[model samples]
Target chain A: MSSKEVFRPTCIIGLGLIGGSLLRDVAARGATVYGFNRSTSGVRAAIKEGFDVSDDLVATLQRAAADEALIVIAVPMHAVGDILDAIKEHAPNCGFTDVVSVKAEVLRLVKDRGLEAHYVGSHPMAGTADSGWNHSHTGLFKQAAWAIAFDYAVENEDPGKFWIEVFTDVTKLIQLAGAEAIPVEVANHDAAVARVSHLPHVLAEALAVVGDNGGILAQSLAASSFKDGTRVAGTSPALVRQMCETNSAALVDVLDEALILLADARDNLAADPADISYLADAGYRARTRLNARSGAHKNSVSPVKISSRPVLRLKPGAYGWVSTLKQAESLGGRIEVY
Target chain B: MSSKEVFRPTCIIGLGLIGGSLLRDVAARGATVYGFNRSTSGVRAAIKEGFDVSDDLVATLQRAAADEALIVIAVPMHAVGDILDAIKEHAPNCGFTDVVSVKAEVLRLVKDRGLEAHYVGSHPMAGTADSGWNHSHTGLFKQAAWAIAFDYAVENEDPGKFWIEVFTDVTKLIQLAGAEAIPVEVANHDAAVARVSHLPHVLAEALAVVGDNGGILAQSLAASSFKDGTRVAGTSPALVRQMCETNSAALVDVLDEALILLADARDNLAADPADISYLADAGYRARTRLNARSGAHKNSVSPVKISSRPVLRLKPGAYGWVSTLKQAESLGGRIEVY
Candidate 1:
């Protein structure tokens, strides 16, 4: 640990998949992590697995107050506001942040509560289909982007530095998993996610409706493509419902646009077979470009820093001769060969 | 080997991903395999790997005829017609089958040429994003559903029974990998694939257009949701185009239905938030069911089969524990309590 590395007693409220995962990653990085959850069994499981957890909100807040650690409200979006209110009553002096999918509304709530300076809105674009602490792992955040939203209060009061440092620490853990940090505006981030994330959920659900309508036959014949398309449909209904309600406008915009595209393609296909070919070709080109870019980005990012090492190559058609020469080279030492 | 296991010289034409994979799986079960390909390198590579491979189609066909083996056509959909014509002219005596995505058109072409009882249509609903022989593996068909489509002519001649046995042999190899065999009408199979397979490609490509219009920033922000939604887009453009073109009616019908569903959802989201929740919940339920079903299926299938030796569990937890225990129990060994 560096001398300048700031230590904050971190309180992760809700020991679910994201919360528990953050707790594990932060604790492993030498942070004092205190987890709070409603589920007694969940808390017990976390403790048994060697995590610093608690069930008492009062005591958790007191400890955070005493240590002056940041409180990360890592709960469902609907419960976040209430949790923040509870935390405010108990630990007013503590710094606050959240790990939620939708950010604009949460930021609005923080501002309305007059906790603007104390709170920084954050959303880590990382997760899996599974839920609960049992499914949480320490490496979940590695290589994922953690978006942090700031306001005038943070920048003017020099609180931005503290928030940045906290986010940097969080990003460091993410970097370990080969993820990158992307700074985006709360509205922009929400809009982006609405198009790419929430809209897919809608489409998947809509597609599922077709499958449901098709009866048992469609269900049995549902292959990998259908499975992949509807994977997001497996997410918590409550969570998805909350997201749709919270980010209704942006999702509507994206969904409307998608419908327009789909309707156009459908019309074109109905008019001419060649039109369908154009749509398919367009999709193929887009997918190819996305994959190529994804590959290039992955190659560019080194998972770990590598120390300088000597490189050696063998000439083609010289397997035996190269092996004999490499043997002699190894006897002399201080040389690397491939 | 069972006495009932039949031996026949099999010639696999166009040794690409599916062809090459089938060749390897069949050979492992003690069958004489002859491979023919346009690419000399592909033939050379197969021969080098100790398989009987030849670049000359006529020579391979003559050898297969001399041995009275079945010939399997594994090539692109558009090329199948020409290949069939060539096969009728060159290897008229040999029994024939195809592993094509669209079977109706191919079946029609075969019937038009009066090659009754000479060929059967098969579609193995399994593939990866990759193509060609280099990506081929013996386990490719394991547990995957292979659809065998027999027309009236073949069925009346009792050729369906013969083809079914050959398919059963292929299915056995796949069953070794933990796959299933499904029989359906060629038209129905094409229709089902149009919904499950072709529709996804169109949807993915449509989604990709969103990324393209928004530029690099849009694509970079595309996380797993976009990746999953667009995974089919990564498939070969030429192949997807052919699928869309060849199976136009079914693909158009599915796409039209999908578009209507999407449009309805979009309108509901814009006008009625309450209805959006219903859509979202429906999706959640469908996805949950799929995930549970897939997980259960994966749990029941064992990795490898051995006659005498006990199979060891690969991992201690939820992933591999069951298979290990089942293998051990099957070997007549009792698990000791520690």
Candidate 2:
């Protein structure tokens, strides 16, 4: 429990994209990484890829517990509880964390199983439309935000140096995996991610339905706009279902809000179609602001800069240079149009 | 009009992205191009970029009419009637077509103005989220589908050689602009593009609204998925409003259907919150099918290839190699492992 408490060999259950990625990264960091997956193919895939993995879950847990290891359940949200139960039974003394989309529910379940003090919750905001071990890469977590949900049980437990070091080591491990560790309350994390992540999945799914109904003509005419707007629709159905089901409360709420906004725009178009730029303007401004802000604060976790400096090359008497300068000023960017 | 009718200079009114890109491409094909825009700055920008552009709409139309040139109205949908009226008044004998998203209304307006024989309808399914002349490029329409709505008036007037040659010339011009000329009925064009184009815009705008509501936290967590899912949200609001407003009938219908699909998914999630893969699987299959179809027939306008061949390389004793081969076969591809 000292400040010098070393990170033990890690046990990662469920060797999907996130699990496989974590195993590859953690093992490369000089920490022994043991992996387990229920599906025989998942284990074989990892083993074939030159990793140490096993299909026997209980044995992996017992071995991990003997080393006081950090057991990470990298399964779907619904599958996390069963893994926790197995960990409690076979790896009773092991500290644990999880890489699930829904943080509040997992944290609550950990508390229900009386394992809160030994558990932390993390969610990486990094993924692709593809899933599984083959799609997983060691660099998946690089430059991504790994959200660490502040567990209530840990706050309520004895405030000792050991607990502090344990939590700090977990954060260090997350950083070692090539992501920024962001501390957030579980409720806030779920709600915020619902807006950014889950809501888009729902909308993309619905968009795909419309495209499917339109048949050949729709497919032929679908361009960059439609393709990008529904890129997530091509993802694995089980993963999409798991994410929505586990984060149902926040997701449904956000979906309802989004529908209301869309309905309002639709009704406005229905009423007076000519000047519907109000909604469009609002959307353009908001999206661009987010993009500019994202560009401005890409490396640092701090708030976005009030001003940015971007270099631009302008020819002699460049048309629209004045407007471009004005726009840069409005966005709080200094443009040196030479 | 003989079969040897040469393509005369094209006078394009509304020098935006589509118009500017067309102007650059058409002029590069050795056909003279005259551009006109209502805004003085737009004309100035085009002229500065070494194109013949003027702010005087009447002068451009008169000159084009004298050459019996084809005038392309490349403005927003709502602005089409005004331009049509101007063309009819100033360039009465000029052959005309429009590049509006909604075809039926524009065609009806052409008939209303008694210029049916002089007008054709087209909607090029190519655009970027960024609009205006600044973002326009010569290759915007390259490999894109340029849907030419078959005009009913021309069909009713006469199935003569001259009319056929005129239509052929227009199609050749569209090809010269680096796009495939797809002849479709106006009604069919409207309905199909509604599902593929307009519906995605509405959904993207709504997702952007939700992001705007979530503020900084949502913006920070917005990753590649959310970014791609809402890329269209940053497009010009005026354009989105116009497309939705002018094509309200089809857009509203598709929007309603999308909402129903989304609501069903939401209700199912709320009801069980355990398994909603039915909807997800359907969406995944549809999207993948579209992607594979897109890849298969990417070069032809014909219905997408029912099967495809994709090359793959596998190492010896690769785990799941058999399954990978099976998947390739199912997807109409052959695999070779060396």
Candidate 3:
């Protein structure tokens, strides 16, 4: 570790899929990481996978506090409150982040609980439908964009402050784990993910029910589109509920927007036979943009590599770091530090 | 070829992805097949890939007319009208079916044009975001479910008739291409695919617009769920429009249902922050059923492979063949002669 670097000794709480994968990636990179799982079976599985893990949360948190480790709460959104409380009691001074899908609720809860000092919110845009320790593996986060969120209070403060330093340390840790760390504001993270992530879960659920309503015949007729649209419906309902329920405000906003679009499509289709042109054309244009920007149209995710990553100069604005990270993301870059 | 089999000499029109792949698969299986492409470039590409293809649609139809070929119309819905007109002038006696996504509209068009004698509707539930002869491959239809639709009057007609023979030939050809052929009523096919296929296109287009509206940060944060949910948005806009516009009636029905579900989810979340359990749990159960029955949970499309397909007895229902084929599909079986 460098003399001034604060990016070592990762302490991951809730060693399920994301946490176990983090442990694997960090340990494989020869970085120090200790993980804790509430389930003894999860700990045993992590150990069997040759990862350092414990079932004792409080003790691990104390060790994390002593080592000044970067703590990652890699649990579902609903489970985060308990983990946050445990951290507050045992590892109050540790630099911490989370991999929850929703950011605003967790940020609010952290602030309300007075544990926001050493906190920088995060949500790694990774994972499969499967969960648990055994399903986790190294390289799960490779090339994935991890959203590192800042509180609104961090805008005017000097970027050299301890909190900003903690965030930079978090970004360094995220990059080390093989993910592209995109900086964002807490409010933006929640709203953006509400569209990209949370709404998908909701839509997949509705699609699943609709297909099932078509019964075995429809299931037999189901092809790539149906399969892809409902793939996320296979996720555990508990996690899905937490994702939708916790980000309820942003989710409701996107949900209303989606409903409007769907309703317009339905009404237009009813009135005119070929009026789906509006929906289809706009969607086609949007997909073309996405394909051009992200190379997501490829069979694999292949964002163009920029050899020289231009450093972001935080512009004078309300939450400049959010746009800074977004700019870097558009250029296919990640942050090591602010 | 077996003496009892009337299946041979396949004539495919439209050398796009599905048509080109069919040409590759059927020819590789040692079936006598000739493909017709309206585009000279497509024909050139197919010939370059070592397949028999011609840009002369009418002459190809004339040759197919002489050979008593099983004609397959592999074009989009709008294009099918001109092709059907050409066939009426060139090879009206040939046994024929279509691979259009929407079945009822084409069926009605065929009937209205007095070309319904040997016509059936078939949709091979396969394809990628790509198109054209160059993007085609041999194994595109491997393990896919091809929905074969029947006329309602066929329930009372003897299964040994010439039309039934033509239908059986189509199924045999589908199986030869390594796809399961499920027979369906024309009306039922439209409704079922509205839920399983068409609605997904509509939904995916809406999702693409929604995500793009979230701007670049949301795109950066997009993961597998978002990717999967909006995948069909990358399809050709004309194809998407045709699929939606041709099936407007059924699409509207399913779209309304999907809208209601989204609205309910939003209202429920607004009312009780944690009440998404209904939507999530229902979706979870539906996906569970799909996974269990189809083994769709596997990385590959695996329906439990049945070693012996039970012969479907024509039940005394309103449409026996439809139910019979659906029953066979539920057991991972395909109709060889029903």
Decide which is better by lDDT, 1 or 2. Answer: 2
lDDT-superior candidate, 2 or 3: 3
Predicted model with the maximum DockQ? 3
Clashes of each: 9, 0, 0
Evaluated against the true structure, the overall lDDT of model 3 is 0.81
Cα error, candidate 2, residue B320 (Å) = 53
How do these models rank on lDDT, best leading? Answer: 3, 2, 1
lDDT (10s digit) by residue, model 2, range A1-338: 33353456778898888998988998788677888988898788889888999999988998887777778889887688888889989998877788898888898899899887677788888989887888788979875767765444225544344344445556677777876655566877788888889888888888887888887666767778788878998878878877888888888889888877767766675674434566788778878877787665566567633222332333212454434433432332222322
Clashing pairs in 3: none
Candidate 3, residues B237-296, lDDT tens digits: the string is 888888888889998998888888888888899985457998999999999888777653
**Backbone clash tally (model 3):** 0
C-alpha TM-score for every candidate: 0.82, 0.83, 0.90
Question: Between the candidate structures 2 and 3, which one is better when assessed by TM-score?
Answer: 3
CA error at residue B68 for candidate 1, angstroms: 2.6
Question: Tens-digit lDDT track for model 1 on B272-334?
Answer: 543577777777777666555446465545664322212232322234333443443333221
> Considering summed lDDT, which 10 consecutive residues are worst modelled in model 2 chain A?
A329-338
* Tens digit of per-residue lDDT, candidate 2, span B163-260: 44455556667878877656666777788888889888888877887876886656656688788877888887778877777888787788788878
- Candidate 1 stretches greater than 4 Å from native: A1-6, A151-179, A211-222, A296-338, B1-6, B153-179, B272-275, B301-338
